[model samples]
Target: MTNKLISLLDYENKAKQLLPKDTWQFISGGALDETTVLRNRLAINQRLLQPKRFQHAGFVDVSTKVLGSIIQLPVMISPAGSQSLAHDQAEEATASASSRVSTVMVVGTAASRKLETVRKVSNGLLWFQLYHHGTALTEMLIRRAEIAGYQALCVTVDVPYTITAEKDLRNHWKLPYGTEMANFTCDEAGLGIKSNTADARQYRRPPHVPVTWDTLEWIRSLTTLPIVIKGIMRADDAVGCVERGVQGVIVSNHGGRQLDGQASTIEVLPEIVRAVGQKCEVFVDGGFRRGIDVLKAVALGAKAVLIARPVFHGLAVAGDVGVEHVLTILRNELYEAMALCGVNTLAEVDRDLIYNCPSTAPL
Candidate 1:
């Protein structure tokens, strides 16, 4: 009999072997030195866990509510684009898998499936991740996303300029033939994009307008889907979201994709949480691959956490089923970690369960 495959780390190893070198690099590479990429997870591991061995494990309840919706776990899928590179099922498969695990799916603007198709495919709650392409394209996408039944619109505000990963550049990675861009018309995306990516056959990050605090209102005007502003690394920005009346803030640095040397998402989570801990719900993601990491974020006051690359690895190996397994693995891990830490319910997790490590000391 074949041994059980219960861990996402096992799936990650399998995915690396199955995917092409270029695609693998694009999925994993961070900008420049990638110091922050390693820092993201390492920082989380630096956190010390004190076990209360005598406490009763009791009923393990990891369920938490985000943007007023309760989820089985604090983890959710971050919007990853170009699923065609990992598997043929693309966003449709991801949507189905996220639902299977009962976690919210954050669909990307660059998804291979059209916004409508992803909505149809999703079996659970959904959120649409937006790229600031220009007001017209942005508005149209928002309107369609609302019609498609997404619960929230996550505006990714960090990547104004593109970072061409050296691996994707060296590999000359290109999409397979017959891939389609379902959201926009063929004529709208004219060829002369500043982004150097050669594989972008039809689209690139929108160049017309970059996002600013002022841009939030324009997006608000488009639809009622609660806006979740992602890519915030500072406490001031977290506070800004509360002022803007946005529903949520993702404490992220684009998984260290945009600014290579910035603080790991874990390092900034506490500050952001402290800033708006009372004003709004804060979700954090970066270097968070373990159950302890989710607890760390919740202890620091995050309402939820997002896992970006691991989901891709799972998909590359087994499509929707793979992601489902990954989420379940994390859910189980969080349960065990919580029980070990002497807590059960999500609300029971607080600052007493966490402490900042001095390894984060000046280095």
Candidate 2:
């Protein structure tokens, strides 16, 4: 069955069939109207690669370092909350898959398994993704991650309020029973979700501690781990992150789950990269289903790209093997793309490798 899974879409299709209806809707749907979801893919398609075929590209080397961590490819798993919905093994299976490929995995704050369990099961690098619940909760989570052997702290700063995806609302989805965010004391954590009406949904928002540019310094003071700010799209925000001592920035739009009409992550990648790529590592994620999309991000100056939905699709279809297969397929596709573009190493990928047709068109 895995042999027939020729593309990432294949896994997506298979996973859709395998997962429960409410579970699939929660994982697949985006914000209200979902224009952002469509925009994410449309923006990526707009940038065409200027392949320099027949340059004796030879063996392609996709390995590179992202914020001092060595990954086998230019791809890393994005942090997505509540993994048990996808599969029973949850984040543990994902950790094993990442370790098998020697890439990094940013364990979500709402992961089904505890941070220590993920760290103990996987041999690869782990970065704890911090969603601020409060000063105390944030500090406790960070300290736990440090003790559990995580490599860095990726602070997700975009979600100021609870997200309200239409599909989730229509389905009245709630966090599955027995699923608890393992990073904190179950009673003190209070990170689990419960049912609520559509209008009252935003009002009954989860425990998302508000954070701003000022919060970065306070977080930095809490731990010595390298800070990677996620959910930054604007060039000024990227610049601000670098100026404020951040080690990395992830150019993302919350996988089109936050704002419904905002620009896609790919559409905003070049500007963010230009603003802070030199000073701090720039990463991106959103609508990146193909290896070619990964190549385009690197060419535009991203240190690496993160993938979440695709991996979830893999997990829903098969456990650890499914996740591993997803990574392998993407890695192989990226290799083919690199060779076709006549680039032997990630260093050879640059702005010249892509032709922005829209930018060159007559205004």
- Leading candidate by TM-score: 2
- Cα lDDT of model 2 by residue, 272-293, tens digit: 8878878999999998888899
> How do all models score by TM-score?
0.91, 0.93
Q: Tens digit of lDDT per residue, candidate 1, span 302-347?
A: 8889987888877887888877888888999999999888886889
Considering only N, C-alpha and C atoms within 3 Å, which residue pairs clash in candidate 1?
40-287, 41-287
Off by over 4 Å in 1: 1-4, 53-57, 177-180, 185-200, 204-208, 356-359
Evaluated with lDDT, which candidate comes out highest?
A: 2
What's model 2's lDDT at 25?
83
Alpha-carbon error at 146 in model 1, in Å? 1.0
| Structural RMSD, model 2 | 3.8
lDDT of 2 at 339: 89
lDDT of 2: 0.85
Candidate 1 residue 327 Cα shift, in angstroms, is: 0.6
